[model samples]
Target: MVHVVLTGFMATGKTEVGRRLARILACPFMDIDSLVEVAAGRTVAEIFANEGEPCSIPRTAAAWPRPGPSCASRPDRKRFSGGWGTPRAGRSWRTRTAHQIGLRASRRCSPSAHLRMPLPPMRSTLPSSASTTSSSACAGSWRDGDGVQVVEAEARVTAEGAVQEVEVGLGPRSYSIVIGAGLLPGVGTRLASLGLHGRAAVVTSERIGALYREPIVESLRAAGFHPTAVEFPDGEEHKNLAWLAVLYDRLLEAGLERRSLVVAVGGGVVTDLAGFAAATLLRGLPMALVPTTLVGQVDAAIGGKTGMNHVLGKNLIGAFHQPRVVIADVDVLRTLPRREFIAGLSETIKYGIIRDAALFRHLEERLSEVLELRRDLLVGLVAACCRHKATVVGDDEREEGGGRMVLNFGHTMGHALEALTDYRRFLHGEAVAIGMVAAARVSRALGRCGSETVGRLERLLKRAGLPTEIPGGMTPTALALAMQTDKKSVDGRIRFVCVEEIGRTSFVELTAQEIVNHL
Candidate 1:
């Protein structure tokens, strides 16, 4: 077994390159900075200021031995599932399985030299610094006197219109979220590569079915699987026990078996309903998602959270049934209604605020490009969101730890607004947009964050064409009541995910009335 470690200078895209390599290698991906943050219970910047950088070394080092999950049964070697999977664990750092890859940016490299850098072969050293002007040439590697090999590589963006993948590293249940243009037509071939065959159920709405059912079914058929398309009415209102029942009947009549694959192809509503169906039908089936909408691709379809909305709350009833794979075809997004597309940006913005300040800044800097549907930037945003979710989910798959709750940075009030409006006043993303504003305000009220932080968030939301204020006419009292029923509420107190800053969050518990006071 071999361990691959990505090390590089700041702004060199170590995290991004590591994510891509992990997806290609099919293994668990982790960052030293993230590990240190998790261990210290603080952000890297905070750690550096208070404890100094050297203090982080021990914390990061202690976490290096184990890659992921428990490996008690396999003492000799820790086997991973993805591209980075084959490394043996040891008692000491020197004897441990690790292949260091150092990333660097060259001043001479040009845009025309941009190309996807392939992974180096195991135990093989590449030229330390090949032709710097040639994008395809090796960036290089070197060995220390201690005999440890560290490969030096230059990270470059792939040419426009290339497929990228983000892996959700959950040990054996690990799966990849494929992002790119015109990917819908290749869904079958990808699924077949995963060793999934036999009966397959394609769950989607009639409207979505009319648009994509053919290509999906044809792809599955070409992959040698028996394909069946199950259609339902579209819209948030139809995501209920009734629709779930209807889905069950259609899948049953279609002769789906326990081992059959359930593929959902639509927006958040369809993903939630179909995922719930897949989770419960026949005691759960392997599922895949072809999320077409911006919201679906970034938030709904990636994580294993699948459920329909209850009359009282959004996602009130759901299970953590992960998908086997997710294919987010950017091309399908072209057909999305303008409002729907804009609404989807809410979740993407949430990701930036909660975990990735850089992503948030990128969105702020390139909002127009995103709005214009710049394929390259859009794909990067989607992939970045997926990476953040995958990291959080990997750490706390069941949300048993409060760690995963940060992902709900804006959902506390968002759900209430959705429930109060009866899912009519706003799209899911739009409501979340307002909820984020509310969360920011609450954070300031509680003194967890400053008005400046709130202002930056509000400004970004407004610039993105999202609602920053809750719609008038809905009493705060009524809104508070709706929030009381939220699943995150504890003993009638709403658990608000408050942003301490742009990319840092903490949970605060407040009663319904207390929440209204802040609002």
Candidate 2:
């Protein structure tokens, strides 16, 4: 077998992604980290520090070179090569000049320089670059701040229009989050393919249901499902113990079972209540989350993690229950107000920060359409994010160690903010916006993150219509109390997840005051 190995500094999702790609390719995916751990009798961290890259890189490279056609004989063909970041101005100029000066240099010394520019902070888009040579057009996205994102979309003019699909794969349980203007017309039919049969419940808030209920209900009926629509009250205040009981009662009254399915159609609160109910009822039932808003589509629906909030804190009453499918209908976003759309962007930006730096770039270029809620782009944007979240979720399944926590890039202060606001003043995505700003500040305090990172995240938040700072009239004490009970933390230290640089992050334990001081 020709083994293809993936390498990066660390926590670049090599092991998790490699395994899944291997499965798709029908090949054995080996974990280099695990192998090194066993061989050197140490952890990846230990090996890097003790043996260093000078020794480790060669050892890793030595693991390659399977029996294949030698490069000497097949010099015309090339396998693969890719890289990241920028170069020192003078150094890059010299290399490019050298290539142009010598004819033989192109073969002997092929040089690619991705100059260091202020890229979109993890989660949004890179700024418009007239001079930047990205590996591919619309390569990635970067976060500007709170709800603000700079989405870069690449285009090359030609006779025939080319359609580049941005997508998300959740293994067999996967569904699409297409962001194109053409996606909304028949989403219910697309969802039915995953198996919504004679009976299905449409769980959403009354406010949201009022707007788009008819088409969805009709769609479900057309798909042969005995559709029943249930709309709870709107707002996070309703996402609590009392609301869940109502849903459970409604299901019972309808005589639903594990065989039947629950289709959550709305924002985060709707999905959380519906998903939690689906996870617990009959020891688990099939769920197809049709996230309407950006927040629901990008952040809430894809991840298996779901729960109603306790009076004490946000997401404290939750479970790690994977959905059978997540259909993020981007068309629903058109119905949303600008602020609501921005809230969704907040979560999308989170995906960029926690995972792909490239996603940030896409947002930068397409900021206008995204802000305008251009229906055409919604499906692709949502799908790209769904793929991002689904990939992490499939690998972790359960938040064991640091596997799933990466998804909580801004939730540390986010949850606390929601709790402090009584879950009414700010939407979940809005809270995340403020939370990310706070986290960036804390990162700066630790001497890890730079000022530019803070500015990028902050700007995105504003553009997305989210708050950058805590709301007025809230006590720092209540916020601190909320942080103490954050579900992701342990030993009551309020462990915050911080990104040292773009495309990388680390979990660090911090005190409530530490977070408060930044605020």
Candidate 3:
């Protein structure tokens, strides 16, 4: 068992490089900073700012894991490795270059000179107590207005084509969403890189399992893991407590341990049900999501939101247990029926209206190419949406903060519509398309945004082959009744997310009557 430790200056790509190395070695990876943040419930930046450097020194040292075949990472500026133990069964693969180079810097060297060249020695004794605050070293140059410009060496190309990683900034709970083509084959390696090994439960629906189970199982086996594939009946109806019970039974029968991982591979239904199981099984197990559908990739699979629907309302029973990682492979989306694929565009369009004008325009100008699934453009589109979601999640992991509510742009009525028809009448995204248009009308009625905003949103939905109006025969009274039970309702008022204009949104608390009145 080899314990790999990655220590470097701030922003030197220690975390990213550690992930790559862990993937290659088929071992688990641990970031000390991440663990510390988790333990403290605050970011490293906040810790350093509030308590100063010495305060985090002891905390950092305490976060180090016991020696094992694991990959550990932390910035070298604090030199916490002095307290780290070596792996019991094998040698410690610790990167000593950062500290060793710091030692060789002349006492009188200027900060700029220090930045211009590497220290004379690449390997030397680690310093007992080093200070980046010293005026004589270039370490200070790395800091500009509270930001660190990391060296570009952290970026590396692999044979798997281009991959875009968007990190969700949730302090200690932060995780990465990796977007690219053919990512399924690499899922095992990535999980192993996170220091996860041993038994894993791969959960999916019957249909998706048939299409993707073999590749996922094969990849896990190659990474020296024992994987148990579990499948349940597919559909929104199955995303309920009964199926969740079935998943728990299968997982336990498979003899999964507390350290065992739960990997969700399928569309939203699978991810939601499987994710709920992972969250409750054994009190909680590590989870990784590989969302197969367009809706799952751009929306469902990103945030830590997990749940099964209740008879009363959509996602009424759920937990916010974030996954260790999300692997979205665009190639698998090709298997989706064309209608489902087009419906997925609704969420992409929502991102534009609520947060990004440029993204909205891209959808307008490249609708045809995107529908064709042009590889490069699609990858970029998925990555861009992931970034927007990451930002919102990072700012409000639990949705307790007002900032994250913007993400609920169209879900208010969308959820109600799903429950009204018993999750059979319309797909999630299709319902959201109509909900978005309805919200826009509500916004206009309230004098928050102009008619032009509503028109543009409707046009985009039409171009993408999505419905922009409530279905006929679906009475407003029934819709209002269903919405009153929605999870977003507070004190009998819906905490609705309304569009102020393109790229901005505001929350409006309204009675179910107001919602139906606008529609």
Instruction: Give the per-residue lDDT digits (tens) of candidate 3, residues 230-349.
Output: 999878999998888888899999999999999999989988888888888889999999999999999999888998888999999999889999999988888998999999999999
Q: What ranking emerges by lDDT with the best candidate at the front?
A: 3, 1, 2
Q: For candidate 1, lDDT tens digit of each residue in 171-219?
A: 9999999888878888999999999999999999988999999999999
lDDT of 2 at 224: 79
For each candidate in turn, the TM-score is 0.71, 0.66, 0.70
lDDT of 2 by residue, 1-519 (tens): 122323222322334334433332333445545654566677755655665444554444443233344633531211111111112342243234211110111111111112222222231112321123312222123333322122323221000111123234546655444333334446567667765577778888887889777777898888778878888898889888898999999987877877888888888889999999988988987887777778886778776779888888877788866666565555567778777887778888877776777777677567777787654455556666767776776667677746777888788888887777687778788888888888878888888789888787787668667789877777878778778888776776755778776657887778876777765
Candidate 1 residue 14 Cα shift, in angstroms, is 23
Model 2 residue 433 CA deviation in Å:
0.8
Instruction: Name the better of 2 and 3 by lDDT.
Output: 3
Model 3 accuracy (lDDT, Cα)? 0.76
Q: How many backbone clashes can be found in candidate 3?
A: 3
lDDT of 1: 0.76
Please tell me which predicted candidate would have the highest lDDT against the true structure. Answer: 3
The whole-model lDDT of each prediction reads 0.76, 0.63, 0.76
